[model samples]
Target: MYKQLLITGGAGFIGSNFVAHWLAQHPHTQVTILDLLTYAGNMANLQSVADNPNLSFVRGDIGDKALVSSLFAEKDFDCVVHFAAESHVDRSIEEPDIFLKTNVLGTHNLLECAKQHWLYPGAKPRTHLFHHVSTDEVFGSLQPGESPFTEENNYKPNSPYSASKAASDHLVRAYHNTYQLNTSICHCCNAFGPHQHTEKLIPKTIHAILSNKTIPVYGDGLQIRDWMYVHHTVEAIERIITKGEKGEAYNVGYNQEKTNMTLIGETCSLMDKLFADNTQLQRQFPEATKAAEGKSKELISHVEDRLGHDRRYAINANKLSAHLNFSQTGSFEENLLDTIRWFIQQHTKVSTIDI
Candidate 1:
């Protein structure tokens, strides 16, 4: 379908990747991106698709009803993939009002606009979709060895971030029930890949190691999380938007669970190998001696833990797999290695550009 899709927060990690993936796969589709370009939203991440004729980027807040309405009127977006939000749990703890405004109110604005524009008495097709991207944190931390979160899991959001997302999810469901707006909610696990902002755990650890800075581990670092590559998450979202039932929710994950310490150690080991190989090569060339020569793991530094941090977040993606016949590439380890290599390459490129 050559549809006009509006992707909010398209400059953010997964959103940017989704936009790129969708454009590449569906060459006929056109995408308009609305992002406020917050701290986590990096325009540089979308540089690869910046010049694509099928893509348009607009910097604006989702809370701006007039702006959103104008876009709806002008672009006549057939489908909306809503990813804009304040996503960090720690940051949400510090400033919840921002989360409420962006995540809850922002979603409300989008729903209202869509309802007004696409839900008229005699609207065409009468099935425009508003896909809400969410997190598995809404289900709270699971007990040790318990089954993963499923579509039927109760909402037990603990942090400001999850609460905001839960509120948004409720709004989407309410719109579907009350106004008959077509919507689907997708709750995904922790995502890691290229162009991810450095504030997240994996990217932060990689950046710290590359810069020879201390890697901070919270608590005993035993917190478990289900990890999925960004590309896989994008694929899940596309599948949901195209094939999902209205007012339904799906969990997208790799089913690869690992503790924080284990994740950090794996990243450190990868960095160690890359740095060691480079250091040995430097020995043959005196000019390369200035390059950093040491194990990146020496930078490990444990710090205070986050308050009310979820101990574990697992997802049961049976609904996604059985219904949509969706299956991930099953390359978590390989994908992680490739991600580390990308981070190292990006660090080197940034350093070169800075000099």
Candidate 2:
């Protein structure tokens, strides 16, 4: 078991969720988080596990080679669950260099540090693991009728964000094959859950509806994304750390596909339903006038499509399932309902605190 872990970006959406899950399931395990706390990285995401005796936090950048090396020298982590990256597609387009520097250079720095500390420290067998938390976008887009991406899929990343991730993926593979550095990668599909940044589609939809702001969609809104709850993705991460093979990559998926338009419509409808059924929701989110009136969809404004936007993304989880006996956590609607409630709960907290 990986009793000592270095979880980079643990203050972000998926990483933070994984940390809380890890600490709960393995109360004896010690975890140190390294995060830059960028706009998307929120300290509140770790609130649930902030007081965990086995958890620690360090504010820093992964690209800082010196800092990362110093950390490895100080601690003998059994595993490194790397989640830090510049992940926003649009933002990557606007500033591709940032993506390259973080996703590519940062990942390399972490890998070099891990290899130095683990294998050479004792010339030990590969018991130590460097688990790279990656994205399905590295496999590029799928056509309408194309098969979902598998572990064997070819590299064809479309955007700057994905290309940087692909570069990191290749670097990881090279490290494992060349140096025999113990490593694994988990490629996850689009995930949504509590504490997601508003830049993401679901959270943006919820916040837009509650704040009476315009909900913007890109182009025709026909792009499809396979969605999974963050809880399921984190479970998959745990499985990879425990049972995954070194130098291998596993694609974690929920097989829940939904078009952008469809997802937005569903979220709008859910907001309307929640407000209608519960008078408290109406009072709590008074700015959600459109949702209370069942007109939340009216707020949707379709704009120009993003440059080189991928048409669809789907993942084949057969490898992860066959190897780890893992598939999913809950039904799509069940998870979606929980996510909506979580955001609403956050909204309530903010509003109450303001009052």
Candidate 3:
């Protein structure tokens, strides 16, 4: 088990969930979270475990070489789970420079610092693990009948966000090969759960309905994505760090594929069910009362497609399953309802507090 660990981007949705999950599973392990607190990174995400005796938080950017080096020297982390990067495609399109600087240069800085600290002269390999959390977007789009992305898939990133992540993935592989650093990479599919920022598709659709705003669907809403609960991805992370081989990359997914339009329809149906009885929703979100009457679907509106938008992304999790003996848990409907319920609870709580 890793004694001292460093988790980058720990304030973001997936990272924050991983911290809480890790602490719960291993009460003795100490975790230090370093995050830049970007727009998507919220401190409130970590509030559940804010006072955890085994967890600590630090506000910093990974692109800062000096600060990162200082942290590595001071903490001497036995393991690093890096989730820090400019992740949103839309945001990356709006600003590509920051993505390159943070995802590419920032990753390079962490690799160098880790090399100096964990791979010093006479240092033992495999004594420490550097696990990188990446995305399936790096594989670009797939055809309707094309096979899912695997570890051996060629790099064909379409957007700046994916390009940056692809660069980082290559750098990690290079370090492992050239410098003999013990590293592992997991390229995951769409991860959804609580604490996700409202900008994402799932949360965006829910929030739009609640606020009575139009639900924008890019292009034909035919873009396909494989969705997995955040918990499953984190479990894959834990397994990869503890048992995966050095320099090998694994694809993390649950084989739950759905079109954007289909997902939205499902969400609307659930909202209708939840609001059928009582005014728990109408009292808090009057505009969304239409959901109770099954009219929320009226808000859906098609819009111009994003530039260079990939048509599909799916992952072949055989490597992760075969190696780690792990399989995703839960049906899509169950997970989707759980996610919807969480959003409802959060919105209800906030609305009540504001009243």
* TM-score of every prediction relative to native: 0.94, 0.96, 0.96
The lDDT of each candidate is 0.87, 0.90, 0.90
Candidate 1 versus the native: TM-score? 0.94
lDDT of 3 by residue, 79-169 (tens): 9999998899999999999999999999999999999999889876647989999999999999999999999999999999999999999
Q: Candidate 1: list runs displaced more than 4 Å.
A: 280-294, 350-355
Please give, for residues 42-153, the per-residue lDDT of candidate 2 as tens digits. 9999999888888889999998989988887777888999999889999999999999999999999999988888878567574689999899999998999999999999
- Backbone clashes per model, in order? 0, 0, 0
* Deviation of model 2 at 315, angstroms: 0.9
User: For each candidate, C-alpha RMSD in Å?
Assistant: 3.1, 2.0, 2.0
Cα-based lDDT at residue 272, candidate 3: 78
Relative to the unseen true structure, what is the Cα RMSD of model 2? Answer: 2.0
Candidate 2 clash figure, as a count: 0
Q: How many backbone clashes does candidate 1 have?
A: 0
